[model samples]
Target: METAIKVENLCKSYGSINAVSNVNISVDRGKVYGLLGANGAGKTTTIECILGTKNFDSGTVLILGMNPQKERKVLFERVGVQFQESHYQEKITVAELCNVTQSLYKNPLDYTELLKQFGLFDKLKSPVNELSGGQKQRMFIVLALIPNPEVVFLDELTTGLDSRARRDVWKCLSNLKAKGLTILLTSHFMDEVEALCDKICILKKGTPIFYGTVGEAISCSPFEKFEDAYLWYTDEEGSENESV
Candidate 1:
């Protein structure tokens, strides 16, 4: 498959602390790539560098063959980002928010259709603050997808959601993948990663402990469940002191 995003020798530091060190990742077009790690494991830092929101100490980063730093304007047009936490005006209605976001992109998706796809069609006029956690997350996803982006970066997409809502979001993401959108996602939930990701990368302390298919990652561990494998790979005693 064609590469959608690539990171080589990616390193970022804060003072003497290395946030990400010699990290490398490749995301293929039309695939969901999961970035899994514990808190403070450098997953967010890695993504910020890839998105050009944060400068790195040294490394090469590419999105669809364009340098994120050099082609930021062009890159922003083709890629969507849903941060781990996002806030909107308390009284802003869902429809109103969509209209504003739609205006920013030249090739925006149909707001009505997108809302329906996310099961937020009936909540179009509801204020953002009034929506449930799951609904808000869905709305945020809709906002990201409104630009009709080729690649999307989602951080903790289903965090704080109940199990039923999380499953619903998973189904929505699976549909997006089926429609050929490349997605890069970060999450603490291993089950979510297993359900949505075609490929997986497990990060520990600014280093990649595993990078390959989800099945391959599972096989590398002694456990049968993906969650168990994840814990083992990130465990201090179990993790090797080497990057993948």
Candidate 2:
């Protein structure tokens, strides 16, 4: 299988505090890789380092066989990232925002079609801040896809959305998956992980407890349910050294 994203011994520190330590990940093309962890497990930090948005203490990161730090311009053209938190101009309309984002790319995707796909077509005239939470999330995703990226990073994609809204986004993502778009996402929701991830890396206290298929992770744990198994990997009393 073709590797899309690879990180070897990725480490990051904030003076005395290590945000991530010896983290390793490898994602195959057209597959979803979930980064599972609690709020302070270094999920976001790891992603930021891999994306070259933040400097890392040590590690090698490659996206589509190109180094993210040294070849950021070329690498980013084929990558899309939707951060956990995003700030947009409050007064920008969906169309206007999409138009602006589209201008940045050499060969942008059809934003109008993307808006339609995400069910934001009717909100073309609606201001970004005026949209509902779910709609806003969908809009962000739409903007990310404007680049026609080969790999997309979604942090907490469905965090605050209602069940139906989350499912809606999942359905849209499933469609993209069908078209062979690779995805890397971080999430606390096991259901989302189950629905999207083909493989995962579970982090605990800035360290990786496990990295492999979901079934492998569960088999390594004492529990059958993914949520229980995830907790098993994160809990201090649980076996953090076990991996598949």
Best by TM-score: 2
For model 2 the TM-score comes to 0.94
lDDT for residue 221 in candidate 2, whole number 0-100:
87
Pairs of colliding residues, candidate 1: none
Q: At residue 72, what lDDT does model 2 achieve? A: 86
Best lDDT among the predictions, by candidate number: 2
lDDT per residue (tens digit) for residues 154-242 in model 1? 98888878898788888977887888889999998888888889888888889887899889988998999998988888888654454
Give me candidate 1's TM-score against the actual structure.
0.93
Q: What's the C-alpha lDDT at position 130 in model 1?
A: 91
lDDT of 1: 0.89
TM per candidate:
0.93, 0.94
User: Model 2, range 1-244, lDDT digits (tens) per residue?
Assistant: 9999999999999999989999999999999999989899999999999999999988899999998889988888888889988779868888899999999888889999998888889999999999888888888888889999999999888877888878888998888888989999999899999989999999887999799989998899899999998887788654534532
